[model samples]
Target: MFFNHWYKLVGMEALNLLESFIQSAETGSFSAAARRLGLTPAAVSKNVARLERHLGLRLFHRSTRRLTLTTGGEQFFTQVSDPYSALRDAFAGAAQDAGKPAGVLKVSMALAFGREYLVPLLGEFLALYPGIVPDWHFENRPTDLIRDGFDAAIGGGIELTEGVVARELAHTHVVAVASPAYMKGRPLPRHPSDLAAFDGIVRRSGATGRLRAWTLRNQVGEQAAAGHRARLIFDDPEAMAHAAMHGLGIALLPMPHAAPRLESGALMRLLPGWYADNGPISLYYPSRTLLPPRTRVFVEFVVDAFRTKGLARRFDGR
Candidate 1:
C-alpha cells in the first residue's frame, strides 16, 4: 500500500514537472513561463530540470538568449501540445452551457475595413449574443494573434502560423480613385502611361515600412506604374482616400473603401479596367477541434453577415 501510494505521488509530481517544462518550451523562456504560472523563474527552471532528469533525457539546449528544444523534446511537445490544448478547452467548455455563448471575444481587425463594415454590425451581433462581450482592436498593422491572446482576427494578407486557420470572408481588389474636382483641370489618363504626368497620393505599407507600388493589370498585361509623381504619401489607406477626396491626387485605394464614395459621386475610378488584386480578406483563428463558444458564434455571425449582405461580392468589385 505504501509503495503504491509513493508511486501515485511520483506520478503526480511528474505531471506537474511536465506542465512546467511544456510552459517553458512554449513561451521560449523560463521567465515567461514563470510569469504565466505566477512562479519565480528559478522555480520554473527547477521544474524543467526535474522533468529532464526524470525522463533521463535532455529536453532543451539552454543558451544566453533563448532555450531551444532538443529532438526528443520536440517530439514530446508535438505529441502533447494538442491534447493539452484540448484539455484546457474541455475545462472551459464545462464552465459554459449550451445556448449561452458567454465570454470575452477578443478580436483584431484592420482599421478602415472594420470601421466601414464590422463596427456597424456590432449592435446586431451583441443583440443576438448578449452573453458575449466584444473586445476588438482596430489598427493598420497585423497582430500576432496567439502571442497577443486574440480570439480571432479579420484582415487580408495575414501570415499563417502553426495552429492557425483562416476562412475567406471576401476578396479584396484595389483601384485608382480621384475626386471629380481633382480631375477637372488635369488631363484624363486614357492609358497607364499617362499616369506619369499626374500627381499621385501613395500609401506606404504598415508591415514593411516602404511605399507601395501601383501595379495594375488588364488584357494588355500587368504593369507596375512606379514613376508617378508622388504629391503626398500616407501610411493609412483611409487617409489616402480622404486626400484623394479633397482633390489631392489619384490614390490607389481598396475597392471597399472607395465604393461608398464612388456610389456617392465623391470619387471616380481613374482606370475602369485596371485594378490590383490584393487577394482574399479572411477571418483567422487558432485551429481546434472544439472552439470557444464565443469565438465560434462570432465567426458564424461574421460569415453569415458577409454572405447575406453581399459583402464578399462587393469586395471583389464584381
Candidate 2:
C-alpha cells in the first residue's frame, strides 16, 4: 500500500496534484484557487492534504483567516512554479496544434450589446466552425475573468487583472439621443448647455449607485455638462434606450446601443458635434500566449468582422 502511494505521487500522476498546489500557493487561499480551477475549496484542500501525506511535508500553516506557506511550501513553490506553468502551456499548445478549433468556448458579454450586435453573427460563426460550441453569459456588469472561469469576455470599461489581457475591438463613445417625436416640438439643442431645457432619461451607475453625469466635448476643444433634468432613471443602458425610443426623454447612450435605432430613425442623434469618450470596447481573455485555438480563432473572427463591417468608424462619435 505504501509503495503504491509513493509511486503514484511521481511522474504523470503528479500533474493534477501539483496544479492544486501551484494555484493555491499563488492565490494564498484555497477558495480563490478553487474558482480558477473550477473546483470547490474543500476539494482543493483535500488535494493539498493528500499531496502533503504523499511527500511527508507540511505545505501550509492553516487558519480560519489565512493560509500561510510553510518553509517547505515556499521552497517547493519556487522550484516548481515556473516549470509547472511551462508544462501546462506546452500541453495546451500541443492540444491546440493537434486539431482544429473544437469544444465549448465560454464567453461573457454585456446583455443588450451582445444580443443587439453579436448574436447576428452567430449563425455564420457556427457554420464556419462546426466543431466549436458557444456558451455565453450576458450581464450588464463587469466580471472578474479569472474568478468567473470565463474563456473570454466582450464589453467596455473592464479593469484587467493579472494574467489577463485585452485587445481593443473598437474605440467607444457616448452620444445623446432621443426619439424624433420627443425632439420635434422641442427646440433642438444648439449647444451642450442647451440640453438643460429637455427632460432626460438617465442611467444610474451600477458601481457608484448614483445617477451618471456626462461631460460632453466638441472638436474645437470645448466641453460642457449635458445638464439634463432627470425625468426617468434606469440602472441598465438598454432600459434607457428603450425609454428614449418610446419618446420618454433624451438619453445619453453609447454608440453601439444607439446605432441601430439611429439608422432606423427610431431615435435621432442629439448634439451631433458633441460626444463623450467612453473608452475601448475590448475582447478580454486569459494570457494571450496561453489562449486555446477556439479562443484565438474567435478573437480573430470578431476583429476581422468588425473591420469588414466598418464598425470601428461607425462606433466612433465622429
lDDT of 1 by residue, 195-232 (tens): 77778898888778888886677756756553467899
Candidate of highest lDDT: 2
Q: Whole-model Cα lDDT per candidate?
A: 0.80, 0.85
Clash numbers, per candidate: 0, 0
Residue 222, candidate 2: how far off, in angstroms?
3.7
Off by over 4 Å in 1: 1-24, 29-83, 95-98, 219-227
After superposition, candidate 2 runs with Cα above 4 Å error: 1-7, 10-12, 96-98, 288-290
- List the candidates' TM-scores in order: 0.76, 0.86
Q: Candidate 2 deviates by what RMSD?
A: 3.4
Show pairs that collide, candidate 2.
none
Worst 10 residues of 1 by lDDT: 1-10
Candidate 1 structure lDDT? 0.80
Q: List the residue pairs that clash in candidate 1.
A: none
